[model samples]
Target: MYKNIKVIAFDADDTLWVNETYFRDAEHQFAKLLSQYETENKIDQELFKKEIENLKLYGYGIKGFILSMIECALELSNYNINQKIISKILDIGKEMLEKPIELLPEIDDVLEGLQHRYKLIVATKGDLLDQERKLEKSNLLHYFHHIEVMSDKKPTDYLKLIQHLDINPSEFLMIGNSLKSDILPLLEIGASAIHVPFHTTWAHEKISEKEQEAADYRTVSNIKEVMGLF
Candidate 1:
């Protein structure tokens, strides 16, 4: 099936290593800290709203998430949030940033099996520095031919990458956890995609079942299933 595929792109966050789990944990901590002012449900909703609002300016990654948490805390608390609580929020962000990379099962084996046979690259959206740091820490950097820290994952972005790599959409394959960011965009551009879902997903990345049904992509149980495709 992959006989024609020249470039195999992988997403770096939940697809490659632990990401949203930390974010989810942080959200819980944030809600607990602010629970005195509002219900946990309301705090979660407000934080999500703030995250969506800040997406344009902050994009995606730990730093933006931290800022949104701070803003949500202030707004939820009527700007009367305690300074110590703010410190704790920052600490949560720090811990997230410093968390070790927990690569998915058989990621190394899959990469090892394919690295010599195909052009492997990371096509992920996040803070460039943070992604690079994680890649370095994973000790898997040597397996990939390139790394792309995309501002957004739209058809146009994949088109640009295809052009840059001098490959046709039909010759490229994308694999990731988000249907919205990683799968649908590539499929729309005529590239093949594989959806390997992480257990947890961010609210914004969630897609309707109808959308998933309509998209032409393969779905797999884990990263190791990628090896079977070849």
Candidate 2:
């Protein structure tokens, strides 16, 4: 199936490592921290709304998320939030940044099995420095040809990546957890994708069923299945 595939771009967060789990944990902690001001449900909704509203300005990453949380806290508390709580919010982000890199099961095996035959690269959206730090710590850096820290993942962005790799759409394949970011965009650009879903997905990455209609791709329950595909 991959006879024509020259480059396989893997999504970094959630796809290669344990990422969304940390974000979920952070959000839960955040809601608890602000419990005095609002219900946990309300806090979660507002924080999500705030993050979406700030995405254009801040892009995607823990840094932007921290800012959104602070903004949400200030507004939710009518700017009456305790100064100590504000400091705690910053500490939350710092702790997230320092979280250890836990590679998803079989990620190394899949990469090792495929790297020799195809160009492997990380095509993902997030803070460049943080992603680099994660990759360096992952010890899987040596398997990839390069890493592309994208601002967003859309058809145009995938086209740009394919162009950069000097490969035709058919020669490129993307594998990731988010169907919205990884699968749909590749299909739209006439490329291929394989969905390897992580246990958790960020709300922003979810797609409606109507949006999934007629998209051609393969999905595997785990990353190990990838090794068998080739």
Candidate 3:
């Protein structure tokens, strides 16, 4: 069934490397910094709301997240938030940026085995500079023929990528942790996708069961299992 697939696009965050863990840590830190202004739960809720509200304005990734945290802090403290706290928020983002790349187990072996047979590429959403830096640090850049830093992963976006690769929808496949962004959109475009769910999913990426009712795709608990499919 995969014989027609010519391109294999992998999601970078969570799928290839640990990402959400850092964000979760940052969120907790932010909440603790603002504990006097609001309860931790309330602060977390407000920050999530603010991040979603600001998505259209700033897009995704660490820089946007940093801005959102600062804005959330200011509003929570009624514009009375300490400058030092604001500086600490920036530090959180910086620490996340500087964190070492911890790739998923056996990911390199999977890539190594499949790279020779397929056109492997990374299709992920994040700040362009941050993503590029991660890829560089990861030292797995040689495996990919293309690297797409998507603004948003939608059916139309994948369509453009398919066209850019000069391939039909049937020839493209996506593998990622998020069903909402990585799998569902590709399925809508008539491309194949494999779901490799990460243990912790972002709230925005979680979809209702009804949304996945009729979609057909394979799910694997581990990256190593992917090799058996190809």
lDDT of 3 at 188: 90
Q: Candidate 3, residue 116: CA error in Å? A: 0.6
> Candidate 1: where are CA atoms >4 Å away?
none
* lDDT of model 3, residue 180: 96
- Model 2: per-residue Cα lDDT over 102-131, one tens digit each: 988888889999999999999989999999
Candidate number of the best lDDT: 3
lDDT of 1 by residue, 111-159 (tens): 9999999999999998999989999999999999999999999999999
For residues 32-53, write the lDDT of model 3, one tens digit per residue.
9999999999998999999999
TM-score, each model? 0.98, 0.98, 0.99
User: Distance from true position, residue 21, model 1, in Å?
Assistant: 0.8
| lDDT (C-alpha, whole model) for all candidates | 0.92, 0.93, 0.95
